[model samples]
Target: MGIETYLVVTDLLCSREFPAEDGRSDLGIAGPGYHTAELATSRGTRVADASMREEVMERFHEEREALAGTLTEWWGEPSHMGLQTIRLRTATEEIPEPWARLSHLMGDVYVWEARQCGRWIVLGVADRDPTDEIQLLLTATETDPP
Candidate 1:
């Protein structure tokens, strides 16, 4: 919604320590137990024409890229990744809870391997509620929510 939101989330994402639970900090929130930190912005209701929908998607991508750039300064370049690729790669492995779940939710995901084994730094964008808002999620995951 604002630069501050992205800046704060970027700071949180850059932190080396993983969160103990799903919680809020700054304008966004973190999720180690659940998945990762997330932020959302509404593009008004989706009761619009196709061109307007396209505009919403484009804006979301720009926002995602902006945050992704900040993470890159700390995490280096992310692996431009997709769900099908991940699905195939993890076909023989047990994909982490929200990681698997994220694949279904995200339209775009840029991944950075964490310093901790089996953990990951992920930035995602998706309009889970197209009629309401588009969500930007940043996650560092090592646990599943109970």
Candidate 2:
């Protein structure tokens, strides 16, 4: 498959004002004293063979780093950044509704979190098959101090 990219943004300010029918604008349910926003994307690559995995991986990293740079410019350095594993399960699996649907693609996930502009921003990327591309998910949430 050729390289494909997707992005989703969720902001309470924008959503509460201008809601999206597809629900991409919604921050979903949040407890008292908290609000959230998010941006997610999928990056797919097209290669003639699996040997090109390295090249595809490089491109994925580039895209992710570029996104990080943008976040840094907008929010300053992240308070926390690291790699973590996220597992995905299939629909047949009795897991959360959201994750169940994503079970077809289960693997390691990378994440970054920061507090900026009065919100907590979370950036994540799910590990994909070396023969394929990657997916990125970003979220920003507002919370009141106790």
Candidate 3:
């Protein structure tokens, strides 16, 4: 069996196949977050609809812009107070430090706060290689769960 990678946007997932080079092959990726299962084999990465993708993309852009400003401010100072209280237990173990670094290097990072009780920070890191763009996301645990 060969190692493989996939792409994800929302609940959808897709796998890529590449020509074998040397002993390995390269999988073309379109987005972050990967999943093994398929909604239907025939679908093979078929997007839900142009409208849905657009909506998500729009929200993503809005988020990107918002974070750009927030991160720029955050990077100026090592720390900043979060508006929401995030639960450590519910937090994902994999944090977006690398992405944050990339964002910082790129000149800004995007940060946001949950309305009720958590802080959500997202960092967009474009790979030096123009072909690849990745994002780093992070969240600071809150003392109290809101």
Pitting candidate 2 against candidate 3, the one with the higher lDDT is 2
| Candidate structures ordered by TM-score, highest first | 1, 2, 3
Model 2 pairs whose backbones collide: 89-103, 90-103
In terms of TM-score, how similar is model 3 to the real structure?
0.26
Instruction: Tell me the deviation in Å of residue 46 in model 1.
Output: 3.3
TM-score of 2: 0.43
Off by over 4 Å in 3: 1-46, 77-122, 125-146
For TM-score, candidate 1 versus 3, the one ahead is 1
lDDT of 1 by residue, 1-146 (tens): 56577666655555546556656655455555444555665455468776776787778788888888877876689887766554554567777656666775675588876553455677777665456566677776655311
Residue-wise C-alpha lDDT for candidate 2, range 1-146, written one tens digit per residue: 11122223423332333222224434432333232332333344444455455565556556656666665665567544332121222323344322322223323222223433444555444445554445444444343111
> Alpha carbon lDDT of residue 101, candidate 1?
63
Best TM-score goes to which candidate? 1
Q: What is the C-alpha lDDT of each candidate?
A: 0.64, 0.39, 0.30
Candidate 2 stretches with Cα past 4 Å from truth are 1-48, 83-118, 129-133, 141-146
User: Sort by lDDT, best first: what order?
Assistant: 1, 2, 3
Listed in order, each prediction's TM-score against the native is 0.67, 0.43, 0.26
Q: How do the residues 85-121 of candidate 3 rate in per-residue lDDT, one tens digit apiece?
A: 2223125443333232232323333333332323333
